[model samples]
Target: METAYIKTPVGIARIEGDEHGVSVISIVDEATQLSPEIPNILSKAAQELHEYFEGERRDFSFALNPRGTDFQKAVWQELRDIPFGKTTSYMELSRKLGDVKAIRAVAAANGKNPLWIVVPCHRVIGSDGSLTGYAGGLWRKKWLLEHETPPVQHRLF
Candidate 1:
């Protein structure tokens, strides 16, 4: 596996992956430098992330090989299906998973997502339409959600 650190508006992001695909994109409070060897997988993941941050890319088409339990993997896959510029509640996700009572478990799975923006974990919110716990921090989550929302055009000249 290869690793690299990328600086973004939210914070320092650590990317890890291999030929199979990117496995993780995590936020760290401190900045850390990566080794000089840049693997192809890491390089591509970094480039795609940069495009995403620049508002030039809406969808990620790269392969992902995130490591997690079966339930966690299921939750992550569901998260990826969430459309861009849209949000879903934890309860909603539980319902989709065929267990409306598993809200807490769904939230737990979301919190463990290792793919970050690639998996679109930030698109999940609280049941009452509030920004909830995010592994990358709530402020960053708010920024990501706002970034994905389409801009409102005004008629004023």
Candidate 2:
């Protein structure tokens, strides 16, 4: 798989994939070398990510090939359906999947999401609207959510 590391506002993002599609996009806190040359196959994905960070794009159009079990794949698919600036809860996701009791499983699948912002696992929150567990760290999650939020306009009157 082709790999590229790009620096972002929150941290260094590691993107991996090939012609088959992007398989992983993870954030890392450690200091690491950025890719000297972006692979030809991953250029689009890299550019799209830059647009996303710049608030010029709301949805991704590139192919995704995240590796996971059937259940995990299902959960990830649902995550993609979440609006760019909206948030959903674990319980709500479980209900959408037609299994309220499967909340834990759904949470697990969300936690295991490998595509990062592409899949939008960061959109998932606790039932109480609290920012919860994020493999990349809660701070990064908050940064992502805040970045996606539309600015509230104040009245000049």
Question: By TM-score, who's the top model here?
Answer: 2
Number of clashing residue pairs in every model?
0, 0
Candidate 2 has its poorest 10 consecutive residues by lDDT at 6-15
Angstrom error of the Cα, residue 124, model 2: value is 0.8
Q: For residues 1-157, could you state the per-residue lDDT of candidate 1 as single tens digits?
A: 8888887778778998888888889988865774455677788778888899999988888889999999999999999999999999999999999999998999999999999899999999887899999887888999999999967999998
Identify the candidate with maximal lDDT.
2
RMSD of each: 1.5, 0.9
Worst 10 residues of 1 by lDDT: 30-39
TM-score of 2: 0.97
Question: Model 2, range 1-157, lDDT digits (tens) per residue?
Answer: 9999997888889999988999999987789998988899888889999999999999999889999999999999999999999999999999999999999999999999999899999999998999999999998899999999968999999
Residue 77 accuracy (lDDT) in model 1: 90
Q: lDDT of each model, Cα atoms only?
A: 0.88, 0.93
